[model samples]
Target: MLEAVVGLLLMLLGVSHGVETYCDGRQDGAQCYGALGGTVVLQLMDNTSGISRYQWSIKTTTTTTTIIRWTNNMIVINAIANRSSFTPSDGTFRINNLIWTDGGEYELEIFDSDGNISEKRTLQLTIQAAGYLPIMAGVLSALVILLVFGVAVVCAQKKKQNNKPKEKEDHELTYADVRTVQQPVRQMQKKAETEVEVEYGQVKFPERPQQTVEPA
Candidate 1:
């Protein structure tokens, strides 16, 4: 029974040495945005024991397969990896002068001398052109400019409205000035009509003047 228990313990210890997954450069499956001719880092790891060699590969949108190598626990991709060379060190992969073509999925495999292979770890990389950033900036600037112009136009319209006089007020003032200037002319015309009326009502008496002269 003791021998059987010892055997079981050994088996458990061996199983514990199986390959484990780890990402040192980028937190497992993190996103990185890079511009043209920019550098980005990739991370990988095999946490479990019994891992003697690591094989790294990349698959691009072009459906091309690239085999990566391990030297001194580092995966190195020379210029042959792509148009730009990439160097991996200390669980970190450095991509030099990234290009749009460099965007793709990267797979890492850890292998043991005993022919035990671990599950592949995948990391996604994205590369963009420097021009794209500038275009976004220009769009934002245009929006700001349009907003300022709209505000200025609204302010100018408000000022114009405030400066103008109301139509009703203007008409009332004009009518009042006209009536004041014509009042004196209207009064003189009324008096002339009254004197004409008195003249018409009166009659001439020539005999009255002759009697007055005889009495004197």
Candidate 2:
């Protein structure tokens, strides 16, 4: 677990140890490393007080870019060298957000106030996709282990849920709807208060005479 964590941090942080590169210019000083999208700090000189002017440039196969230069006590950072900073006090040049193209040999030229040549030094920098691969085998192993552990946890949870028996469905109840309709009641309307009930008698007329027509 610790190894996995360390590997992950290395891959993410791009953390690497920097060797103290002096202004010897004799030894091709040990190489420094910068991680992609990371930062790198290079020590150019011990003291800036002795140096009246200095220039730093990185030489790559395709092109050479001036990272920073100081002259007449004025510091001028190259327009192309973005995210690069230099401190006159410590003579340290820091570059952030490194890219693959930044890998190259860096050279420093120091001059005195009298325009006299001083000492020169050079250092190499390597750009890696990750912080340290040989140390941790990159981030692949850690990611794989994490992925496997996550999948196992998911499978275990699914198995637990499947093992739990579903409760039997409750019996469905049948229902019959009953409805009653009421007959309408007739309402009598009131007329005049003195209106009496009138009754009509049946009139019957007796047969006047059974008149037979005499045969004349």
Candidate 3:
């Protein structure tokens, strides 16, 4: 019973601490996505009414490193000591020529001359090894292959259709060749009919020989 009570008290304390931490700033910690060899900018969103000194740190799973320290002047340190720059006119941290080693949780802690924390912002960056080109290329190649295959299929179907035998026409004298053959046949029939014998004199029947019938 005592252990359960203690556990409940610790849990309440943790929740209160989380609430205070989240309520410390106007905005929550930001999340940024980046491609390999791209640039990233971490900006403090608070109204810098009376801030002077600013410090930026990057924390990985293994180590925490300070990247920027700014007061009257600005300085970049550690792994990003060369690639990082700061703009005092506006509290912006720009990291150019990003590498895969740069992916981590970045924290910006700002303080005034009185050593009061004006704003604390965290930016989480996730870096990808490759950009969109590889996936797009694969999809485009697949589409082109499918298009080529579709064209080949359509062409094959057309060739097969063209190679098929055509149906014979049953028309006898509808075409010129048919009419030419029929004209010769009709003329030959007419010529044969006209050449038959034609009688112009009166028809004479064969006379029967008279038979002598003396005894009768």
For lDDT, the strongest prediction is 2
- lDDT against the true structure, per candidate, is 0.58, 0.64, 0.60
Which candidate comes out best when scored by TM-score?
Answer: 2
Ranking by TM-score: 2, 3, 1
RMSD of 1: 20.1
Instruction: Give a tens-digit lDDT track for model 2, residues 1-216.
Output: 656656686764454432122222223564777776667777777657856788877887787687777876678666445577766677667777777877879877787778876777788888876554543554566667777877888999998887664322222111111111111211122232223232112122243456788898
- List model 1 lDDT by residue over 1-216, tens digit each: 345445554554443322122225335465555555556655555232344566667776566465566544444544345533333324555566566766777776676676467556677766766534554564556556666767888999998887676766899899999999899889999999998887766644433455345654
Misplaced by over 4 Å in model 1 are: 1-28, 46-51, 60-64, 71-89, 130-216
Q: What TM-score against the true fold does each predicted structure earn?
A: 0.40, 0.52, 0.48
Model 2 regions lying over 4 Å from their true place: 1-30, 60-65, 130-216
List where candidate 3 sits over 4 angstroms from the true fold.
1-28, 36-41, 46-50, 73-98, 114-118, 128-142, 145-184, 187-216
For candidate 3, lDDT tens digit of each residue in 26-94?
245777755565566655544334556777778977877887666654453434657666555555556
Q: Which ten residues in a row have the lowest lDDT in candidate 1?
A: 14-23
